[model samples]
Structure formats: structure tokens, C-alpha cells
Target: MIDVDVLIAGGGIAGLVAAAAFVAEGRSVFLVDAGPGPERAATEDSDLRSTAILEPSIAFLTEIGLWPVFADGATDLATMRLLDAGGRENAVRTSAAFAAVDTGRPRFGVNVLNAPLRARLSAEVAQLPGVRVRFGCAVTGALARSNVNTVALDDGTRVHARLAIAADGRDSRLRKAAGIGVRRWGFGQKALVFAVSHPLPHNNISTEIHRTGGPFTLVPLPDRAGVPHSAVVWMERGPVAGRLHALDDAAFEEELNARSCGVLGPLRLAGKRAVWPIVNQLARRFDGPRLALVAEAAHVMPPIGAQGLNTSLGDLRALTALTRGAADPGAAGILSRYHRTRYAPVAARMAGVDLLNRAALAGPQPLRDLRNAGLRLLDATPLRRVAMQVGLGAPQGTVSGKP
Candidate 1:
């Protein structure tokens, strides 16, 4: 029997970080992935997604000793600009920008490319004292019981642990084994993600353009080859996004520049394009028996507002704290606390994202006008500051500590 204090299924950033967190608390962990090595998975050619790491989230990573790696590669987000460029060309509405100064901070957050983040976290976890990682291996089956949970791997190995965490993502086998059901719905939209270089600098600002199909966001990235680059998330109706994804590089750049409304000046593709179906999902429960779900295994929000991974980190934060002092990391009490702390908030966040996405995707001109007006109003008032704080996943009442 391969025994460990905790068994984390899924070798994504979340899973690796969870293992690191547990090991930091002096617990033993076995981490497994059904895919290639972290280094292979994180290469720019493999994964094109980027995560905007908010201040608090960065602090959590720092506590786990993995921030330095990210800090070296991330681009700071000092401001956020939203433009309503949906509807007809003549009907395009207001544009607004929110600066971090309103929140008393020098910058709101930092955007880090996924590949490097994963590579760093994976490397760090691999070197931790009490963590064992098995890449390109999967948890083929799981058996949960009153006192312990055992997982069977494809290689005929079995792992016994006091707690099992299902970080395997949306199609989590561990979650199914734990009998946890999820409420999921598709938005009939897909997100096209890639990197781009603009003739003009972004000046450390992140921009989101709300158009009829969905939101087109440009998030800052560290300069490359003496030029400025940003990661792009272009959302559109399913078929439309598919068509756009099929466009030649020249055509894609032309369309991207048009959608951007010349805000960043002419833009050109800096990396390959990748598409993902947009969905909203929340597991019915965060815990089951001796198991718990974190990250996408627990909840998935639309790519809007940079909420997806941040919400996952929230789950890790709660789970790590709940299991910190527990003798049995997967004990009933600890699992229950994690569920109670995460469930309602996650559900609420999913609902909010769903509503916001609906507004962004609404077809009616009146609805689009209302949405744009509301965004303009919010931007013009002090409320935009509050919205900025909340949108960035900032803790309530957190003073930026800036005089």
C-alpha cells in the first residue's frame, strides 16, 4: 500500500499548490496527474491561458513560498478600463477606467502566464520535503470510507490517505466517486485566448470591452523583444468564435484590431490562439466523506472578471486553514468546516458571474444600452471603486494601507 497523509488528484496549479500547502504544515502528500509533466504542460505552446493574480491571492502564494517565481514573470495591473463597444458601430456606448489609487494601492494585481506559474509551482512542490508527485498518472478509481479513502491508479498502485482532494477539474472522477453532483450550464459561447503585441503600450492597465457577443479583455504581460504584449480573452457566440479561431493569422489580427476599437492601437497576434467553451458550474457540495473538491472541481465561472482561478484559490485558502491543525486532515469536522466556509460564497459568485455574462451576451439593444449605461454610471461614481475592489476579489474592507 502506498500511504500518505493526503492524496491530491490532479497536477494542475491548484493541486500542486495544495500539496505544497499541506507539506508546509508538515503533512505528507501524494500528487498525481493524468497528463504530461508540469514542464511540458506549462510551455507556452501547450497552455496559452494567463491568470490575473490579485493582491491577496499573491500573499497566499507567498506564504507557500511560490510567489518569488511568479513575481519574476508577472505584469502588474495598476488600472482597469471597461469599454462598451458592443451593438452597432454608431450605438457603441460609454468607456470607463478605474485606477488602483481609489483602493489606496499602487496596483490592483498582477497577470501571470499559466505555463510559467505551473512550472514554478510544480518544481517547488517537487522539492518540498514531504511531497511525492506522480506525473502522467491518473486516479483511475476511488473508494471512500468512514476513516480513510483509497484511490486506485492506472498503474495498479493504490494510495491510502486520511483525506483525498479532487482537484482534477471539471470532469473530476474523484468528485463522482464521492457522490458529489454539480449544477452546470453552458453559455453557448466560447473564449478565444492568445497573446498579442500592440503598437502602443498598455501602461500597466487591463482593458475589457463589452460587445454584443461577449467581453474582449486585454491583460498586461511582461514586455517581449523590446515590445509590449498582453494576453487576450475574446468571447463570442459558439459558432462565431469557431469561425474566428479558424481565420488566418492576418485575418485574425484584422478582426482583433477592429474589436479592440483601436484602444491599444493596432494589435497583432503574438501567440497561437486557443478556444474554450464557457460554462458556469458549482458542485452541489464541497465535501463528501473524507474528500473535498477545490478549484474547478468545485466551481467554474466564466472567464469574465478574472474570477475563475481566484475562486479556486479561495477554496484552497479555506481548506488549508480548516485542515491546518486537524489531526486527521480529512476528518469529518475539517471537511464540514471547509464545505460550510466555501459553498454559499462559491454559489453566490457563480450566480453573479452568470448574470454578468448574460448581460454581456444579451441580444436586445435595450438590454445592451442598459448594461452599458450601468457600467458608465458605476465608473463615474464612487461605486466604481467598490466594484473594482470586489471585482478583483479583494477582501471586504481591506484598506490598501496607502496614505
Candidate 2:
């Protein structure tokens, strides 16, 4: 049997960050996942999504000494532009721009491709002193004792840890084993994630265009071969997205350019495309016995606002803070405190994003007009600043601090 301070049951972004964070705090960590190890998975051409790592999340990563690993590859997001083009003509009606400087920061966040970031984080975690990563092993089951939890792995290894974390995906087996329920609902929408190169520069601005089906967002990415590139998350109703995904390169670019409203001139596919179903999910509670759920295992939100992974980092932040210097990191009190500190805030954010998505999915002209009006209202000076701060994960009444 192997003994550790924490056992993590996923190796995605959240699980890797959890390992690094806990180990940075002088805790021993054992992380297991069912997929192939990072070295192999990183080489595979999967997980084509990108993440916008906001200021607060960057601070947390830098604190744990993991930011530098992928910093060079990150593209800074200096501004966010919201455009309403939900009219019948598919043209822009109202536009609002929010600058990072308005929030007293040089940049709002950094965007990184998910695969490379995971690869770099995995490499870093593997070398950390207090971490043991079992990439191909699955968490079969667990026995929660008063002090330590005994976890069984598919490889026939048993682990005894003070805490067991469910960083697994939304459909998490560990959470089910703990008898934790989730509230989940899906929109009849899907998002197509891909990279595109454009003739016009993104100018470090992330643009989200709201239309009939959903919002089409283009986030700045590092230049490729001296050409401006951006990551696109184009959301549409189920059948529409499927047809778009099935279109040939040339045909798809035609549709893509029309949807973009020529904002970036013309767009050419720079990479492969992948489709992801949109869903909103939250676990009934963040903890059960010695197990704590973080990231998708805890909550899953739409891609709007870049809330998915950033919020997961928030979970790690709260968990690390609550357990620091504790005699038993997984003590009932510590676990309960983590749940209390994270649940309500996460649930509230999920609800906010859900409402925004529904507004973007508005099919009626009147509803679309209402969304545009709301956008114009938020664009005002004071409200715009507040919106930017809140979007960057700053606490109420404060701006996001430097990392």
C-alpha cells in the first residue's frame, strides 16, 4: 500500500494543478488517471480547446511555481469586444469594448491551447518532489475511514491518503461512488472549437458576436508563421453545428466568414475542428467524507466568459487555503469549509453564465434586441469597469491583482 497526503483521481488540467498546488504546500500527492500518460496523450491530436487564464488564476499558478512552465507560449488578452449581430441581416448592431487597462491591469488574461498547457503541466508535476503520478491507472473504489481513505486503483495498487480529490470530468465515477448527486442540464446547442488565421490582426482583443443560434467568439492566439491567429469557439444549435462541422474546408470558411461579419477580414482554418456539447452542471456538494470534488467533477459551465478552468483553479485555491497548516488536510472540518467557501460562489457564477448563454441563444428578434440593450447598458463607464473586474474573477468591490 502507498501512503500520501492527497490522492487525485484525474490527470486533466485540474488534477495536474491540484497535484502541483498541494505538493507546493508540502503535501505528498498521488495522482491517477485512466487515460494514457501525459507524454503519450500530449502527442495525440485531441483536446483542441483553449483556455483563457485570468489574472487571479495566474497568481495562484505563479504562487505554486507552475506558471513559468507554459508562460512563453501564452498569448495576452488586452481587450474584450462584445458585438450584437443577431439581426436578420447578420450584421453588427451594437458593439462594446472592455480593455484590461480599465481594470488597472496591463492584460486581462493569457490564452493557451489546452493540449500544450496540459503537457507542460504534466511534465512539471512528474518532477515535483512530493508527487506520484499513475497515468494509466483508474480509481476503482475507495473506503473512507475516520482519518485516512483507502483507494483502490485498476492496476491493483492501493493508496492511503488523508484526502482524495475528484478532479475527474463531469461524468465522474469517484463522485458517483461517494453518492454525490449533480444538477445537470444541457442546452440544445453545441460549440465548434478550432483555430483560424486571419488577414487582420486580432489586436489582442477577444471578440464575442451574439447572433440567433449562439455567440461566436474569437480569442487572440500567438501568431503562426507571421500570420495573426485566434482560437474560435462557435456555438450554434445542435443540427446547425453538426452541419458546419461536416462542411469541407472551403465551404466551411465561407460560412465562417459570414458568421464573423468580416470582423477579421476572412478566416481560414488553421487547425482541426472539434464539437463539444454545451451543459451546465454542479455537484450537490463539493465534498463527501474525505473526498473533495474540484473542476468539472464539481461544476461544469458553458464556455462563455472563460469560466470553466479558471473556476476550477478557484476550487484549488480555496481547498489549499482552507487546509494549509492543518494537522489533517482531509479532516471533516477542513472539507466542510472548502465546500462552504466554494459552492455558493461557483453556483452563482454558473447561473450567471447560463443566463448569458440563453440570451445569446435567443431566436426572437425582440429577445435579441433586449440582449443588445443590456450590452449597451453594461458598456457604460462605471458598469463596464465593474463587469470587467467581475469577469476577470475579482471579488466584489476590488479589481484583480497582478500575478
Candidate 3:
């Protein structure tokens, strides 16, 4: 059997980030992923993903030395503009200035494509002194006891660690192996994400224009061919997305441009469009015995308001604090405190995101009107703004940014 301080069962963004945080603290950590992740492509590469890096998430990553690597290749959104579209009289707009003045950051976040971020994170983890990643090794079995965890790899090797990190993603194998349960809810909506090159410049402002089906976001990216491009998360309700997915390029493009409200002056499709089912999965408990859940393994919500990866980054930050001063990386006392502090914050964010997504995606006229009025009122009030500011900075533990 092999030995390590902590054994992680996934090597995705959350797993890599958590491994880096522990390695930076001089802890011996082992990361095991079923297969190597994909590499980044040069121009307008979608590879089916994108995530927003919130201001506090950026600060936490920079503190742990992961941001520089991610930033080296990431697309920056220096500003963010929220535009209400459902044909409402308010037609409100909010910018980074709205989130930053309260949070003390220049911008609420930066938006970057997934492939580049993953490629960069993989490299950063490789260079960390104490992180050992074993790719192409699937976990064949797992057992957790009070003092340690034992995981068997398909390669016929066994590893024992004081604790196991479940960074395996939304449908986490490690989480299931430990007998942890989750509450699952589906949005009945699928997100069509792709890149679009528009005639007009994005002007570095990421826009979220809500429609009947759901929010259609145009996240600005560094220009390709000197024509401004943006990453789009086009949420479509029910069978419409499925039918559109089956449509020929010409038909699909026609329908897509019509929905854009002429904001980008005709959307020229770039990169392959991909669809993902939206699920809200929250582990009933984040830790059990010698195992702790991280990232999507802990909780998941619809991709509304820059929540997914930002929430995961926050998990890495909180997990880092839970293990900060322990002589042993996976001591039971440390793990219990981690479960305690992390549960509330993670759960709150999960619930909050779920609520926001439901409100934004509702079909009825009264519901849509109420949501729009709420955003407008919230934007106009000073007391509510300060309250949001304080809530945004609240952290689970030492390393800030979880919720």
C-alpha cells in the first residue's frame, strides 16, 4: 500500500485547487483522476465550458499562488453589466462598480473559458512540491474508518491517507462510496453554451440579458480576428433546447440571432455549441468519518450569477483554512471543524443560487414582473446594497470566498 497525507479522488479544477492549497502548506497530498483532462485550444475554443471568477475568489487564488498561472491564460472581464430584458419598463443596468464599491475590488469577477483554466491549473499542480497526481488510475474501491481512508486503484495499487478529498465533481464517486446522500433537483432546462463573434465590440462588459426561457449571457473575451467575441450561456426551457440541438447550423443560427435582441448586431457562431443539464445537488453532509467533500461534490446549483466555479474556489479556500495549522493534514479534529464551518456557508450559497435561478427562469407573467421589480428596487436602495456588500464578504472560515 502507498501512503499519503491526503488522498484526493478527482483531478478537476476543484481537486487541483485543493491539492495546491495543501501542497503550499507543505502537506503531502496525492491526486487521482480517471484520465488526464483536455488541453486548451488557441482561438474561439469552447470545448463546452466557461466560469466567472469572483473578486474574492481571485484574491484567495492569488494568496495561494494559483491565480498567476490561471491569469496568464485567462480572459479578463474588467467590467460587468446586468441588463434586464423581459420587456419590462424598468430595463435596469448594474455594473462591477455596483459590486466593487461595496466589496472593495475593481470588478466583481473575470470570465474565462474552461479549457485554458484547466490546462493552467494542471500545470500549477504539477509544480507544487508535495502534490503527486496519478492520472489514468481509476478508483476501484474505497473504505473509510475513523482514523483513515483506504482507496484501491484499478491499477492494483492501494493508498491509505488520514482523509480523502472528494473533488470528483457533481456526481462524485467518492461521495457515494462514503455513503453520503444528496438532494437532487433538476431545472428541466439545458444550457447551450458556445462562443459568438459580434459586429460590435463587447467593450469588456459582460452582459446578462434575461428572457422568457432564462438568462442569456454574453461574457466578453479577448478579441479573435479583431472582431469582439463573447462566451454565451443560452438557457432554453423544455424541449426547445433539444430541438434546437438537433437543428442544422443554418436553422439554429437563425433562431439564435433573433433572440439576441440585436445587441451584438448578428451573432456569428464560433466554436461548437454544447448543452449541459442543470442540476442542484447538495450533499446532506459534507464530511463523514475520514472523508470530506469539496467543490461540486459538496453542493451544486444552476449556473446563475457566476456561482459554480466561484463557489468551488471558495470551497478550496475554506478547506485550506480547516487544515491550516494541524500537525497532521487529516487529523480527525481538523476534519470535524471543517465539516461544521463549511456546511452552513456552502449550503446557504447552494440555496441562494437555487432561489435565484428559479426566480429568473419562472414562466408566469406575475413572477417575472416581481423578479424584475425586486432587482430594480434592490438596485435603487442604499441599505440593501450595503447589506449585500457585507454578505458577499462573509466567509466560511480563514480563507475568504466560499459564498
Return the TM-score for each candidate structure. 0.96, 0.97, 0.90
Off by over 4 Å in 3: 40-46, 88-104, 383-403
Model 3: per-residue Cα lDDT over 1-403, one tens digit each: 9888888888877888888888888778989988655353423353557777776888898888887876764566655555565554333333222445445555556777777777778877887887888888877768876667888888998899887888888878888888899999876888898888899987666777765677878888878877888888888786878998888888988888867766778898887988988888889888877888888888888877787777788777777887787776667777778888778887877776777677768677788777767767656766455434433443534433233
Instruction: State the displacement of the C-alpha of residue 301, model 1, in Å, after optimal TM-score superposition.
Output: 1.0
RMSD of 3: 3.7
* Candidate 2 deviant stretches above 4 angstroms: 396-403
Ranking by TM-score: 2, 1, 3
TM-score of 3: 0.90
RMSD of each: 2.1, 2.1, 3.7
Question: Cα deviation in Å at residue 388, candidate 2?
Answer: 1.4
State the weakest 10-residue window (summed lDDT) of model 3. Answer: 89-98
The best candidate by TM-score is 2
* Prediction-by-prediction clash tally: 0, 0, 0
Tens-digit per-residue lDDT, 142-249, candidate 1 = 998888899999988999999999999999999988778989898689999999998899999999888778888999998899899999999999999999999999
Model 3: how far is 148 from its true place, Å? 2.2
Any idea what lDDT model 3 has?
0.75
| TM-score of model 1 (CA atoms) | 0.96
